[model samples]
Target: MKTDDAERPNMAVSIGRLMLKNPVITASGTFGYGEEFAPYLDLGRLGGMVLKGISEKPRPGNPPPRIAETPSGLLNAIGLENVGVDAFVTEKAPFLETLDTTVIANIFGESADEYARVAGKLTDVKCVDALEVNISCPNVNRGGMDFGADPEQAAEVTRAVKEATDLPVIVKLTPNVTDITAVARRVEAAGADALSLINTIRGMSVDVYTARPRLANVTGGLSGPAIRPVAVLMVWETVQAVSIPVIGMGGIMNARDALEFLIAGARAVEVGTANFVNPAAVLDIIDGIERHLGDAGVDDINDIIGTLDCRRK
Candidate 1:
């Protein structure tokens, strides 16, 4: 994490039509509904909190031993254990609405129609600031990777979800593909208002004592410091491939890591997995960005975004 003289922070970030005080947000499915962590941190200080992925129906998630700890990261097969959209609107949404920060609902579905139906329901919920369509879920059955791996399928799902709601649509993409840029272009054309990239890279681990796989689902998405480099490259490439704004996440632990995503061309960055390790990690990242800017003599933060000096050879 380098804090050079040229470093700074973006004054404001617009994801579709919603304006953020800064670009730092908590990744979906990890922040619960935003109320659990309210005791330790100020929810208003964050640009927004993407609530855990809510499905059209309640999901119990997977069996026990769902999470396994790794060196710099952990593997989890929680299977999107959520209280469903209606529960979120009735309970979670109301609580989040009272917060000064924005609330972005992360919606997931098993099929294109499911995506549309859920988006339609979320439209009536005024408290929701935007809709983040989770097309890539490694823990779910029949819904996770099927829609994300193919450009047409991804676009179709995005189009259906977009047509179902007036809320700004942000389609999250999977890293399990060969060319993520191609899918980004397709989803953007299909009516995605913005995009969030590099969802946890799909991965797995084994338990030596049990002589079996660690995660009950056999595999899970990997997040933490280890994925930072790949996330930066994906954000950079996706930014070059599409015209829509990009929200980047993957292995972001602090302010310096957050700055790398911006320099790589992400309009905003989402903090994931790190929350489980350090409850104050998000605030640390935000404060660090501000401190980095002040020390570098840069007042406005937007100036540092996408300022990399790479040249094609």
Candidate 2:
């Protein structure tokens, strides 16, 4: 028998002023505008959905052989292919505005100016509740990983996006840097409403038999179960570094994976690659979280956030 609503856990959480009915949000690139997975999930039931990375102009993405499956994870060099911001406004906005869930646009650019331009375009879109600035994209002006790997450039991009829109800003940080907290603290100082991290770990694989790279780009972002521990550690570190809420994501494949992040101090979590393996994985995560909370006599999910005990354990 299903428990009454009053008896179940309260799953709501807030990222700045953006209130999510629950803490499970589908990661940017993997969710693909939210419409693609409609057949598999009741999109409205999710706390939020982040559309694929979008730019000022439509992108053709990276070359073929862009995806490779490892024993514990997936690697991809998909170069932010999307239908551009204008198309999103004219084509997808109508359908998106009708959904009940929070809609977050994941915007990226080659430069700080470009990031501002893309953000400016989505600012007026009624359906977009917030802007998730993806700093992981290459900085064509400097080089790949320039903005994300450097503290100053990351802060500049965050400020640019913040000035471009009135919507709340969530800056997504990359994990390739030696000091992630340096970048996170800088972005927070630049006025980012919230933070999400760590973007896929930098990785690659060689086709031993063919004597070639597995991906067309020779390297790609690593995601899935392999990076969960790293992600949790980063989230824990960043949370202590900044006063803003942290949205955790990396290898969250199930309830426990998501729980690790929450207990480590993430206000919420985003599910990535797992969507490719199971379309309804996010929904299952939501149910599982509620079940775990219920079993432990937790009435409010917020009670579990930042509850990590590091006292000589």
Best by TM-score: 2
Q: State residue 298's C-alpha deviation in candidate 1, in Å.
A: 1.8
Model 1 global lDDT (CA atoms, 0 to 1): 0.87
Local distance difference test, candidate 2? 0.90
* Candidate 2, poorest ten consecutive residues by summed lDDT: 136-145
Residue 298 in model 1: lDDT? 71
lDDT of each: 0.87, 0.90
TM-score, cand. 1 vs. native: 0.95
- What shift in Å separates residue 219 of candidate 2 from its native position after superposition? 0.8
Give the RMSD in angstroms, all C-alphas superposed, for model 2: 1.4
List ranges where model 1 is wrong by over 4 Å: 1-10
Candidate 2's error at 47, in angstroms?
0.9
What residue pairs are clashing in model 2?
none
